[model samples]
Target: MSDFMEKLRHLIKGGEGCIDHMYLDTVAKVTVGVGNMLPNVAAAQALPFLLRDSGSSASPSEIAQDFESVTEQEPAKVASRYKQYTQLYLPEGAIDDLLDRRIEGFERRLRDDFPDYDGYPESVRLALMDMVFNLGNRGLITKFPSLTRAVRENDWAECAAQCRRRGIADSRNEEVRNLFLMALG
Candidate 1:
C-alpha cells in the first residue's frame, strides 16, 4: 500500500472499530467490518460470511436469515448487542479486503470528481479521503460547497474552516481540519 493508503486504513480502523459480526450502524444500516454497510440481503450474501459456531461457509438462506434477524432487532443498538442476532461472522482477512475495496471505490469516485486529485498535497488528499470515507462521494460533493471551493482553490485554511461535519466526533473533525492545515505549512 502507498503511504496515504496505509494512513487512511489506520485512520478508518481507529474511527470505525473493526467488527467481525454483522451489526447495525448509528443510522440503522446493516454494517460489518470497518463500517462496511450491507444495503440488503443480496449485498450481505455477496460477502464471505461464515457460521460462527461451525466455522463453515454460510448458505444463502442462512445469511439471509441472520441478516433479517439482525435488521429486526432494535435499530441503532450498541454494535455488541446486535451480535446475538446473527450466527455469522466475517474473517479478518475478508474484512481487510473489503475495507481495501471500499477505499479504492471511494478513491475512484474522488478522482472522478476532482480532476486534479492526484496533484493535490498529501495532507489535502488525506483530508478529502477521510471526508469521502465518512460522507460518501455525493455527500462530500453536494453537501459541502464551501469545502469543495476551498479545495479547488487550494485554500487550506478555508478548507479547514469549512470541513466540520455534523454527527461526527469533534476529534475526528479536528483531525481532518489539522490535515488541511498541514498543507499550509
Candidate 2:
C-alpha cells in the first residue's frame, strides 16, 4: 500500500526527476481541456515500479520494480481522482503524447544550456539526456569531459565508466549503465 504522495516523491527521484502518475493526477485536474494537451501542463503519474533496464529517459511502461510492476497495480484511485478533479478519466495514450513532449523539452533545454556543445546523434542525446535526468544539470558539468570523450569515441563501455562515481550516494549504477549501452546501440 503506497501512499500517493510518498510514491510521487520517490518517483521524482527515481525516474530521473521526470514526472510520474502522481504528477499527472495532480496537474491534469487543473488543466482546461486545451491546456491538458500541453506537455508542461500535462500531469505526471506514478507507476508502482521502476523500469527494467530503464534509466533517465525511461517511459512509464519501461518501469520495473521488484515487488510489483505498474501493470500489477490498479489505477482505481487515479482514475477516480481524475474524474473528481477534471471531470475526465483519461485513456493511456492521452498522457503518452505529453511524455514525448517532455522528453523533447529536456533535449532542447540541454542544447540551449550548452549552446557551444558539439553536434551529436540521437544516441548521444539519449546518453546525456538520461544522465542529466538522473542527476541534474550539475551532472553534466561534473562528467563533462568524460561524457564528451566517451560519446565522441562511441565507447559505450567508456561511457559507462565515465558515468561512474562514488563517495556520495550518487552513482552511475547498473540501470544507468544499461541506458548507456542502449544508447550505444
Q: Count the backbone clashes (under 3 Å) in each candidate.
A: 0, 15
Local distance difference test, each candidate:
0.91, 0.43
Q: Kindly provide the TM-score of model 2 when superposed on the true structure, using C-alpha atoms.
A: 0.39
Q: After best superposition, candidate 1 residue 36: deviation in angstroms? A: 1.9
Clashes of 1: 0
Error of 1 at 90 (Å): 0.7
Largest lDDT belongs to which candidate? 1
lDDT per residue (tens digit) for residues 114-146 in model 2: 663336544445556655654456666665677
133 Cα displacement, candidate 1 (Å): 1.5
| Predicted structure 1: lDDT | 0.91
Candidate no. 1 TM-score: 0.92
TM-score of each: 0.92, 0.39
